[model samples]
Target: MRNLFPQRVLILFITVNTIFSLSGCVSHSKDNNDLLCVEKNVLNTANAEGSDALVLKNFEARPANGLLKEISVDLPAYESVVYFSTDHRDKILDAANRIFPWAAKDLQTIISKGFKPDPKAAEPSRNGLYVLFKLPNNEFLLLQGIASPDAMSHFTINDNGSLKIKLVTFGTETVSGDIPLVAYAKSDNLYDVFENAWKNAINTEALAGRTAMRHEKEYPEMFTYLGWCSWEQYRRKITSDLMVDAMQKIEESPLPVRWVLVDDGHQHQTGFKMGDSRMLSFDAHPETFPNGFKPLMDLRSEKIKWMGIWHAMNGQWQGLHPDHELRELDPHLIKIDKKFRGEPLPVMMPKGDSISSWMFYKGLIGSTKKHGFDFVKIDNQNRQMRFYKGKENPVKTVSQHAQSLERAAHELSGGLINCFCSDLLSLMNTKYSAVSRVSVDYLLNNMEKAKSHLFQSYQNTLWMGQAVWPDHDMFHSSDKFAGRMMAVSKAMSGAPIYLSDAPDHFLEELVTPLCYSDGKLLRPLAPAVPLPESAMISALTTPEAYRVVAPLPNGAAAFVAYNLAHPTPQQIVKTQISTQDYQHAGSFIQPAVPKWKVPEEGLVYYDWYDGKGGLLNDQYKIELDGFSDCFVQLSPVKKGWSVVGCIDKYLAAAAIDAIEYNQSELKLTMIEPGTLVVYNKKPVKCAMASKVEELGGGLWKIYFPKGKEKVDVTVTL
Candidate 1:
């Protein structure tokens, strides 16, 4: 790699209380006004040969005025793509952000002269938690904020073509001493760059007490089975009678719904508006749920495995009500110096101390478990920073609250779904929770909204998948506009698959492709992520289909392409898929030898939606209409044979629980019964298959009896 650093460097110090700028090389200065100095020692470095090496230049700043507000860094502007948050909403929960490409020539102009806001603007700029730069030379750099005990950090583009790191603290709380404003890493791989930077950022002495949960931790059991949620079905108007009727319909329907989520409306709260309401008590609302969940809990059986309830992370949107019963447990009323709807706003929060916070969440979750709930979905977690902004230390307050909530939820219930918690501080404090909502609520009818939802869910998974199991939110299977698209997206997500359809409103055909009749989903080995070739391509601006892939069991891969053009593209968009897109599909598969060993015959390609089959040596072209999708499977051909898996399911290969290849026979174990398709150059015999048909060109169709689970069939070639 060409060295970008100089042998001898001269650092200039600037003394400014609010903002400081650095440009070009300058001689070393020793003036009294120069209170800020740059440390010459390199903290961390990654050395790789050729263009793959990502160098970290030595540059550490010591604040001039006891507290540092902002620092700017200048670097060579190249052709790059920037991924940043567009608003204040949590990146994962709200799904409101944009990724754009910048030409090498236009980078300087765009950075120096920021765009002017227009009332009719399609995309707006806002402060971002982290900014990722995809350099043209196959290298990536990620600059992210590290949450400290007293302050949080964000990034902005300065007018002088520099990247600025700004720190936010609780009211009057200063970030003094040697504080690392921003943590960064450079790598050829996107995942490596992000993980390295995030690890370096959070593993500091300042954030020593807080621990982040690993992505490989065991997620909630409900994620493996099909589920139903009450949010989109009944919204805030859900009642006990409605829930009972819904459950009765679910039990009778062919769609196997195992877990039930009792969403927001069941809680007792006080206020005129839903968004401004504060929770009143832990008990269910008397008017809505007269018996307080006993009738609902009675419906649980072998078929209905688990039940979960929803609550805000801070009790409710506006926090606890003035006369809430839990107030006696030592609640802290934080008065905001700001106004909401032209009125003074005050929020009641749990005490920041570990003991008090633990008691606060314990009271809420303990009562929930007592009422027969199996888990809790904590929403509005990102609002903790806003509620306690001026009251307590940002990191300490968020860590304590998150720990208390997760601890209580795990101990009392079995699991917790971290919801509306996409902020850095909240994400860092996620010590035990394994499941998190990765996108906004799935809406109905609107095709644009559906496309946006899919785009957000898939794109957010690029980073959010590193923290927790992504929950794409619930959808309605009965919607005529976007039902199939949503269903296919969920199947490809490798996350939990749930629906919010009203009673007797589901389409069995769409649901069957995702899970078995027993409610067990055929999930991929890992979460689906964007193909490396399509990583920087934005569907909003470009007329291209967004491609995502996930690893399936037994060395197979599932790839799905979505046409997410907004306002709907007029003409069909043609996209090409090749073996390159499916390379990472088997990265998560165990017994890794099956995936790494390339067969002499190459891989077999099967189209799930179109029902086509062939060798995957050449590129496959797909034409997608507006808001449509294309699903395909690629499995390696071994010993002149290939198992196409169960062709009935969307992610067909995931249905194979186990596969063993011997000298002349292949033993296959399946999770569900379906049409098993295999490719063999020689004749094959299978006794378990009721009938076998030879479709020309070495493709054979074997039929397995319906209603059989764990079907084992040996095919002798």
Candidate 2:
């Protein structure tokens, strides 16, 4: 592989998700011993760092403050001895690539290094490294990564202008759980933009990078501030009858129950239920489901779509249920690497127990068709990171996971698999469960908490075959507000949502959806239009409209005007009623009336709606004793998307229409500077709600209004 920048080594990565990258370096004036690594898409400076010797050193001090300090690499698989530094993160990477084009699968830099020229490129196999080749003329073409680590990195970027770079492996959690330090440029205002950059880095490093070797993953995005509960709570009360009952509920839940996570109870041999004694059976714990497995039967009838069995694959930490036949059966199965921290012990990838054991697990799958058991949840596990005994390839653990499911899939066409994890990353798609939890905990209130939970859920959902559906670990919110928040989450996301509450904590209304049904599910109307009115406006207006129309008090003006056309695109037209048309502004109504002067600046502080659930706000300066008729031109935010409603009978009836944008009258569209909404296009289909229902309690149900159907309403602008 030819060196694009022989002297440049340091590359930048977006974050924990994105992989480490390398790039050409730019020379900055060297100042003191304080050093920082910086590189970009283009090569601005050059140097000669001979590649004869290999340097390996780790920094004991924290990274330089206020400067870019990177510590990771982006290549999928390559030879490595880990060390991190601020000054050399960039230069060292460049030097390494020059000497080791075949070093990191050429992934550290999206350039195919060491490939044969011309006709040789046509050969079937590659080194399993991908690069986006943009020719000298700026022509772009997609190229895949090498197939294997042994393959040469042969690719090119002949373009002079098109910019490309690799990932950085900074800010990652080390095998020892230490967060490797990262330093950015002096102007590092690390927030959302910075966070996104890092996520992209590790993702490419781990996923796109070519290598069968797997690495542990991090999911700070989805799991931040999440709500989590210990399985012990349920274990405390597990009874054979209750276990059976819990399974039955699984049968009746809606939406496939995304994840019927089995918590800790099973391992304790904690047979609070009669099923306890049957632990040795390694078969269906029939006592747990006394009614002949009614729960599984119900799911088979379509209540729980995805079913699973939970296990503590690794944490054999507890000295309980010791089975002597374990090590004798398969030495590789029970023994763990000694290098692992703490008391050395084996960790289960697929499972450590007989129930989780390959043979036992395989048999259980076949026997449970009458009471669906399509998933498996293994908890208390981590990736193989430490130097340990009984060590195995990171791929092997995934291999076992795959073998576990592959055995099951042979019997069933498709299977639903998930696990209990705080970031179940590093597992291969084919080898790992279909879904896994990402957070160590879960919570509420902080808006980002809710939004990100869904975001994490969506990210995993988008995986083509659902390799990993993120688990926003479920919990029951005792508060109704929290419940509403959950509904909002369920409605506004793409993840397979689940909840874990003592069924009693859930309100009947909320649980109604998860209740047993005839398998026919009801889907709801989606893509709800955002209201045109501002939240501030919605708080001030009467029940006349979902939107609010208020006047900004301006002198000599009867009232200020406002329109709530925020959610969609529409041209709003209104027939105005003037002062001569209607007079006598309401005044002196209060027991203690206060005089409101015609202020030069039409802003008067009126205390209203305080007792009611509304915020009173309006600033207008005007004289109300006048007469005239006016109309508001309601239309889409875009000049091309707005239209005036056709005033069909002139003054007889009002109407709304989709054809609202006016091309020529862009000037009049904004009555004042900053008047036009710079945010969402305020389009709304306004008419009236014809029917409403009030339950015996305080709940009110409102339905959309239907105007003249099939008839077009021309909006008069």
Candidate 3:
């Protein structure tokens, strides 16, 4: 191994053997006269070249105390560590933010300088390592380990390279305050390293012209919605009544909703197999999709701008599956390695040449695309790396997983690609998919297990093989669903908003505006509630720096705010004017309403009370007592107003105002239990309205009377 330092470094294990509090002193030592702390809890040790000196520890116990997925390293800080857990990216790289400022600064400077272990100089470690620098201050930067996406703590560096993490309080609920803990030196360039690994996700050929639901400015930011729908879910929700109702709903979709992916249903269940696409059939389950894609498929695909399905490549199964029978013919691909609960972890090897891989994927793509899909979510390994032989060729590893999609995209000549449970862009280091899950899969429960979603969204993917997104998977509301949803997306900056809502049925009034797009996520003006709504919330990004804005209806003021490093839910909704943007956009007023306008403000809003199906007639007559906003897509409303709107509750509806609408842009406001309304600042005279269920569409004239007007409108349905 190459020695990266000039001399043998200090190798001390003084795990703060400081029994008694030391008398603060500034005495000179007969040795290296470096700055020294007077406390015995503080012991200085020189770093070395090859020792696993870096260790992860908690202030008190093992809460945020697991292995870290990634970390930075400092030469001579500690010998490289011995980590056996590669399947879960589970290792820690410690850093001395307080004591080793020089090292931190060095790591940043080196990485920023584009330093990396010369490929030729890379020494083989069962665990991959590089003299890599993803940021400036290289020579010793990022040295991350994997800790599965669902891990509780993805990263944790010591505050100082101290071996003891100091803690002043200890209790049952949580150990409060700082506790000195053992840590090794890491570089600040660490994050940029992984960021470079998966940045550039947006510029892919697949999601080129698409946009998130929030950025589509025709409606309220709250009307935006995104979800991950399995092909099975898609088949179930899309029906005749559902379709017609859906068309009406689409007209008032919250955000510009361009992408609605179909997860794990279009392809075969198990892989690591022979190369024919037989097992990986790209068609929907014939049982669920009886009529096939005839009218339902062709017509729906046209109305929605971006749509795709999923494929699981690195999955495992016993001989139970018919496909597993094929694997049984060659069970050698299946083996047990890593011990989980002392039980062997199952693994498998892919059996094929590049052509077979290509052909199989091509078939899958051809099949799915035939059903009217322009986007595809290619799933990855659901097991450990042991399944793929855990080799050093990450390029090969990523290729085995994403190659099919990339090749398929090439064949399709530019289509959206989505990846899950995979190192999506690490293979190409170029913009690949339209959206990608940066953290592990998001479980619906609110769990602050990971960091933050915004951190993952703004990752330095500019150069990494990604330009699409850091998808903060579908949002599930606890009591405060809409509020939490907005926070996560707003935090992601420009990452695409991916959701798992069952389409073809009820539409969700997601509460964040899709504001600006940078190929990643939509930028929002302000986000509302970001705290875990319930035990089911999982934060998957770093809580970086942010500015919070608690928005309320006109005149009614509010001041609820927070200071997270990164804002996730989203920011406040503001103007839609950009330096270079769509020409037809501006403060112009329209005289009439079309069949639909995604998230048209002041329009009628309608939905099943709890996102459930059935008539909402049970909620008692329109109790216009409290200002309530209704949610509906398309409906007739009074004209002659400037900005029209629809909301879920009147209280929410009362929150609407033309804070910044052009006076001549037209005004219309409709509120109460998801009702739609129309707006007209200028006179159009002509009006058209079609009624769908409780949702009524027809033109009525309402001259904006300097004050508010209350009227109970009738629904044709």
Q: How much lDDT does each candidate structure score?
A: 0.67, 0.27, 0.30
Q: Which candidate is the best by lDDT?
A: 1
List model 2 lDDT by residue over 412-475, tens digit each: 4234333432221232333423435543233533332332332233222211112333444554
TM-score of each: 0.86, 0.39, 0.42
Q: Quick one: ranking by lDDT, best first?
A: 1, 3, 2
Best by TM-score: 1
**Candidate 3, 1-717: lDDT as tens digits:** 112222121222212222222234222233544322334433233322222222212222322222212223223343222111112121212110000001122222222233221111111112222223222233233332221111111222233422222211111122211221122223332222223222111112221232221122222121133333433334324433444344335435543344455444333333333221224234444543455544344445333555555555433221113334333224223332343357543433443345544554565567667777665555443222323322332223334435555557546633443443323222232233444444334334322312233222222222111233334445433213233433333333233454443333333334322221111222322222111111011112222222111122332111111222112335322111111111111101111112122122232222223221111121212111111112211122232232223323212323243333333333323322133333332333312223222222222222222213433333211
For candidate 1, the per-residue lDDT at 640 reads: 69
- Show model 1 residue runs off by greater than 4 Å: 1-68, 88-122, 159-161, 176-180, 205-209, 212-215, 331-340, 586-598, 694-697
Root mean square deviation (Cα) for candidate 2:
20.7
Residue 177 of model 3 has an lDDT of 19
Per-residue accuracy of model 1 over 1-717 as CA lDDT, tens digit each: 212221111123223233323333222222222212233211121221111111112323333322235555444344554544543222222322232222123223434334412111233344566666666677876666666555567665554545555655544343344343556666676555555565556555555445553443667787789999999878888899999989888888878899999998887887636456777888999998999999999888788889989988877777776667765664444433434688865556776778878888888899888898998888878766656555535555766788788788768888888787666666666667777777656788877667667766776666566566677888898888889888878877767788999958898888888888888888877778777656665565467888888888777888888877666779998986777666656543322223344456778878777777767765678899877888888887877678888887888887886787765888888777788888787888899888898865576888888865688879998
The residue pairs found clashing in candidate 1 are none
